[model samples]
Target: MKKPRLFNLFLAVNGLLLGLLIMLPILALLLASSPVEIMKLLVDPEVLTATWITLLSSFCALPLMFLLGLPSAYGLARCRGRLRRSLEVLLELPMVMPPVVAGLALLLAFGRRGLFGELFSNLGIRVTFTLGAVVLGIVFIVTPFFVRRCTVLFDGVDKKLEEAALILGATPWQAFLYVVLPVVKRGLFAELIMAVAQSVGLFGAIVMFAGNLPGRTQTLSLAIYSSFESDPQQAFALGTLLLLISLLLLAAVHMLAPRDRRL
Candidate 1:
């Protein structure tokens, strides 16, 4: 009886300490701004435009992430060679790399004088400081999360069911779409929510690669940074909005995560 009570007490204290540490600053940010400040920022044309740009860029990145990431994840889930191991490390590099470093790499690869610069120049295509650059930044930063989560979910799915579908005259695509995907939909949805959350809060990478050009490339996160010195109240309001969005995204992900990961 005493041992159980001691364990329970330890758990309670540990959880309380971490919980307070995490919640305090977020709660303060949420409550720091006045209603008038929030309303004014909400009505501000620049703020509204930046907010829309952020959402548009993030959503644009999602389809690309899903198109490329799904195949990469599926391949990783079934692969076992040294090449597979190397590819896994490569996929994880962006996640472990600093945002600034990732941004620099993107710039070097896609900027005017970058690796493919000559080819792009001949085609009359400009990538940097454009909406495409913003979308690229978001995709670069958020893709690893999407791929990693989907790979784990794909690995946990029953291979037998997919095989059964194949044996029953179903094409590979049909089997995956019907059999495997339905089972893992919840996990995929949760990962997508997390990806969106990550994309929404992206700052360093977008700023470095996309140049934070207002109306053209500036996102809400960049807007917050821009407004901080000139209009602290507006910054606080944006912060509050971001905080609420993050909280909602987290809640949605938690609710949508599969109850049985083995599924």
Candidate 2:
């Protein structure tokens, strides 16, 4: 009994230390810039433009993520055996890969002399260093996160429910839309917010694929990076804003999550 109590105490202390380790830096970042300074930066034209571009890129990537990720996730959830395991590993590769490496991979695939680069160039389309590139970069980096969460959510759904809908004369698409989707709507919404939060904070991939050009390709993350070199105070303010947005999104995700699933 004494040993068990001592172990419990040890666990509690470690948990407290871990929590503080995570919280302290966030606290420092939030307190580094005053509310007035943050507000001032928020109203600055360059900051506003960067913020708009960040939001725009995130939203633009949403449709592509939905179109590509939703089907892929559903397929993954429905699959089995070695093929499913291989596909799952493929999906996870991007998440585990370094962001800089992912960015480099994208550049290699879409740059002027890349595999499909000539095809795009022949069609008079340029992918790199544009708003389109930013959207593409966000989609490439963030879609895996969306797909992985959605796969888990879909896996929890009862296959029998889908079968019942089919027996009621619903097509596969209809069953998915009208039956399976409603069951996991709340969790799906949470994943959407998570994806948006991630997209907003993406830095390396966007910077590498789409060069940081203020009022053009610059996003909040890029803005923070650029400001850090010229003005650390402005960078701190931007970081505070980004942190607040992330916290709010995470709060919403927590609220939407099932009680047992809430973090």
Candidate 3:
């Protein structure tokens, strides 16, 4: 009894410390500006453009993630072997790799003078320092997050449900659509919220690959950095808006997510 009580007390202290460590800085940012000052920054055209660009990039990248990642995640979920582990780890590299390093890799592969520059040029496309490349970078970094989440979600789904659906004369696509997708709907939605938050906070990759060109590649994170460098007052205001937006997105996900028996 004494041992359990001591362990619980230790955990409580550590948890409180961790929570305070995380919240104090956010609290400081929130208290940095007056309401009127926050409103002015919230209304700034450049800031507004940045917000729009961030949303557009997230939208563009999310589809790509679904297109490319869903198939991979599905394959991973249904397979079991040595190759599966290798493949999954390879895909997870992006998550473990530093964003700055990932950005540099993009620069090497798609930069104006790098490996794929001529290939892109031949196709009448310039990916680096462009809006499209910003989208690409965002996708590259975030796709793994969604894929991993979905893979786990799919793994948790009972295998019997799929077999039952097929036995009912449903095609593979139909089974997936009607049975698997519906079962994992809550987890999928949660993954989306996580992906969106990650995309919103993207900074190093966008700055490196896209160069933070205003109205084109600048995102909310970039806007925050630039605003802080230019004017702390406005920066804090933007921070307030950012914090509020993040909370809203999280709340939406939490409220809308369907309850499920999580494994």
Instruction: Identify the candidate with maximal TM-score.
Output: 2
TM-score ranking, best first: 2, 3, 1
TM-score, candidate 2, is 0.95
Per-model TM-score on C-alpha atoms: 0.93, 0.95, 0.93
Which ten residues in a row are the worst by lDDT in model 2?
254-263
Please list the Cα RMSD from the true structure of every candidate, rounded to 1 decimal place. 2.1, 1.8, 2.1
In order, candidate lDDTs are 0.90, 0.92, 0.86
Off by over 4 Å in 2: 1-4, 261-263
What is candidate 3's lDDT per residue for 153-197, written digit by digit as tens?
899889999999999999999999999989888778778887887
Candidate 3 residues lying further than 4 Å off, grouped into runs, are 1-4, 258-263
Using TM-score as the yardstick, the better of models 1 and 2 is: 2
Candidate 1 residue-wise lDDT at 158: 93
lDDT of 2 at 252: 95
Looking at model 2, residue 151 earns an lDDT score of 94
Question: lDDT of candidate 2?
Answer: 0.92
How would you encode candidate 1's per-residue C-alpha lDDT over 164-212 as one tens digit per residue? 9999999999999999999899999998888898899999888999997
Error of 2 at 169 (Å): 1.7
**Cα lDDT for residue 228, candidate 2:** 97
